[model samples]
Target: MNDADNRPVADHPFPRFSDQELARRRRAVHDLMEEAGVGHLLVYGSDRSGSAVPWLSEWPVTREAALVITPNGDDHLLIQHYNHLPNARRVARGVEVDWAGPSTMSRVAQLLPAAADQGIGVIGPLRARDHQLLSESVGELVYLDAQYTRLRLVKSDEEIERLREAARFSDLSVAAIIDQLEPGMTERELAAIVEGSYLAEGATNHIHYFATTPMASPDTCVPAQFQSTRRIEVGDILFCEISAAYWGYAGQILRTFIIGADPTPLFVELHDVADDAYDAILSVIRPGVHARDLVNASAVIEERGFTTYDDLVHGYGGGYLPPVLGSSSRPNLPVPDLHLEQGMALVVQPNVITPDQRAGVQTGQLVVVTGSGADSLHNIDRGLGRIG
Candidate 1:
């Protein structure tokens, strides 16, 4: 079967990882299992969402999939949906691929020796029923989601290169929108432009959210999680949060634009504050910097009588990893007691919103932590975009 990219599903080439990278991931998984003292590891996924399955086995989960790893033997990958078997076999590296049968969890249980009593380490989003079945079958089930996240926190050189490609594709998508934005366009049309920018290039969508409201009487603060049918007017302000993916890796970027006119004073103020917060947050990101420090830098928003409706900054690539932070005025979650490490990717977005949550501007993009500081992976212009 061939996908939209004109690449055969069984032998697609754009997303392959090197054998060395795959082996490095395997070693990390084994080390995690040893530290947790588990005999077997089960990585589960549904609807193509789990990060670990792809990181370890190179198989993007489709429908449902599970990977079973043993310390001394070859790893086994069980893919659900009979039709997906051929592609899973071809794409996945260094793992034995097989059909998962009617019940994926039952197949997993049968793989565990009947006489074995060692605990099993579990990762990914297993359903409650499946959790119960695994618990009954094993002596103990060790939840290793956190450890798995830790394994993904630092990107290898190969992973960073993939992220850079994703970021470039993302920039193209944003530029497409800015170039074609018209006063009478609907939010749906805006989304079409975003996907159109990269779909022919074999990229996929992670997320693309929009908010359109008149600058004179702004009613929406943050970008809506879903697109709208509202017709954009001459003086409307449109802001979007978009991520275009290459394989499973994606780059997230947010920007605001004024349609057919210059921004009003209120809109100008919101974007200026957002730009400052974006700069402040990025200036403090480096190896060994605490998560709290990033939030502290965004205090300019609150100090200037503005606040944020979305996370000021967050870990990105491989999943929403950790250290998700918000401004002091609006705490998304308790600041994690984590420090930055080199090669960690983060989205330093500052969705500076009014105190009443009626207006805002979006600014930021994906960046990688380096020896000196954070480096942006995107080349999109960082300004309040204006369209006519």
Candidate 2:
């Protein structure tokens, strides 16, 4: 591990983890490539859509990029801008960059094996234009998107520590918001305070879902918008789904807070149900638990006649990675039937909308599926809180 890995703050924008972690990842993927009989492993990425690319390359590209691994375990990092080479070298340790070019795919096509039986495997989506070009002389042309995604589901030893650090930042930022919340503060103002606290607490990135409604809500099924300009009023219920990122790891925290006074009996009851649902999901989650089985655990709330709304659970890294356990409101696309393996990092959020449809409460925290069970990342209360 390097100093960048241990740094609480994102002092260096490049890959903060060590070269060894990068090597380990490459080795794992190389083994997969060999099994698939691929001569090369190509992963596509850009400033916006780069998922596995950033984690693999140790730095996100400002433009188009790709990380290619050869059969001999040699790794190559390609960038669109030649000028990025210097910075890439600074962070993309132990990788060759000279092969990178603004127009890299066509060149990569030149690297394709002439034999029809040999081919390149890709993890991320490749553009149609580039995809067509690369396939011209390729062999098997394996699409290993799911295979690569599953590889990232489990948290490496280094990634788990970073996630814990990120979660702490989110917790501290939320605590600041609650400690200073007062009547007449605009939603935008409160959001700024909360967002700033993220950076103050050493978070590199923050994604928050913010909502405030006066008294109990009329619709409990929907989460609040990301951020808005609306001003808050007295007796409003504030809610947020806070996701904080450090290095490349993320931890999501969901919380609901009532302003000015004590929550009503109905609200408290609803929140308790939501908390129970959260706990219930955590109880049954462990290595080997079916992904869909976790969803069934939400009955603790829905059985009581509360409306379960929004996405209930998902995996987190880089962005909301896969293994999405589906949403309560949307049943058509529940998470797949995959077993939850140990080392996988997931967020379990069970949201309950009061039966009256006037209030909603959501409680969520990050967890890593353990050998015996699951470990909750945050130490905050699991119930609805108050701000006065």
Candidate 3:
């Protein structure tokens, strides 16, 4: 049971939440716990490199990581034993924290003994660890994979604003890459420009960068760090996808460009077909649409004249997914039938290829389904990009 007041606000760049906003979200989480009959909820954040915990708390949790929230409305954040200046500051503010080993079980017990003894419903990422800890510490404990994922799915007005800002930064990055389109520049150079632009636009510290040379043989997704050193040549085609994060929110984008000459007639035809298919998926997208149906529509694009990189349509937004959920990192292609509903954001991409041609068409959009239809967060050029 801790209260994190007087938390320093100067060290971080993220805008501190207005007292109103914090109250609103806090109330929302409490309400959700009440509805689910959860006496306490524990949220475990990624401890891996580039964790989003810092972005949320304005402080890093070191090796130890887990957030405990009691139904009485107390927030306790437990972390590993470093006890650096940042950790000390947070702990001093009554953030019921303890230093423990990285073992998940050790971390779980430190955060939930009281709740477990009281027979409170506990939900989070540490059931196994909780059980182990309980066997040694006190009473039996039960936990479900309870998470705030579904609650966080719908964005609040303030959250929506931050996401839009992040998307705008990504859009700016894309435009910068397009501006640098030329035959002589290396893919690495272009990637640098994109990342530099993102930073200049106040993007958060984490970044995922990738680029592709559509005209090259055995075209493959080149990671940003290892973008082909080979210089771009005349008539080279470029495709890039970047996932950007700001204030702990993330959005993905894809854009293509052609250098030295107009895309070949064949390329133009394929691009149009791909665009149409992307729109086709968009057309069927609305509240209550079945995710599998959207996947089926994407398949039609492949059947007509395109190649799908993979069959995938998962929601994306502020929170990164857990391992079990099929996400970009651990893709379980062709996910089971999931219903599409309002407040769910998705990326619909359909890459179409011709039966006789080696080249393929690719197009996609990030959209949010509304009651009436869908709306795009960023508007892409109808004609992707032509450098000629």
**C-alpha local distance difference test of each model:** 0.87, 0.73, 0.57
lDDT of 2 at 166: 85
Model 1, 1-388: lDDT tens digits are 2122434434656477766787798889999998998889999889988988988877888999899999787678999899999888767777789999999998999888641466799999999999898778765688999999998888999999999999999999889987887777788898899999999999998899898999999999999878878899999998989999998799888889998888999899889988988898888889999999999998889888998888888898899979898889999799999999999999999998888999888999999999999989999899898888
> Which should have the higher TM-score, number 1 or number 2?
1
Residue-level error in angstroms, candidate 2, position 367 = 0.6
Clashing pairs in 1: none
RMSD of each: 3.2, 3.6, 5.0
The weakest ten consecutive residues by lDDT in model 2 span: 1-10
**What lDDT score goes with residue 90 in model 2?**
63
CA shift of 262, model 2, Å? 2.3
Question: Which 10 residues in a row give candidate 3 its minimum summed lDDT?
Answer: 321-330
The estimated TM-scores of all candidates read: 0.95, 0.87, 0.77
Colliding residue pairs in candidate 2: 217-358
Deviation from native of the Cα of residue 132 in model 3, angstroms: 3.6
Report the lDDT tens digits of candidate 3 across residue range 122-190.
444444655566557645544533345565555666666666667777777777766765677777777
The local lDDT score (0 to 100) that residue 358 gets in candidate 1 is: 91
Q: What is candidate 3's TM-score against the reference?
A: 0.77
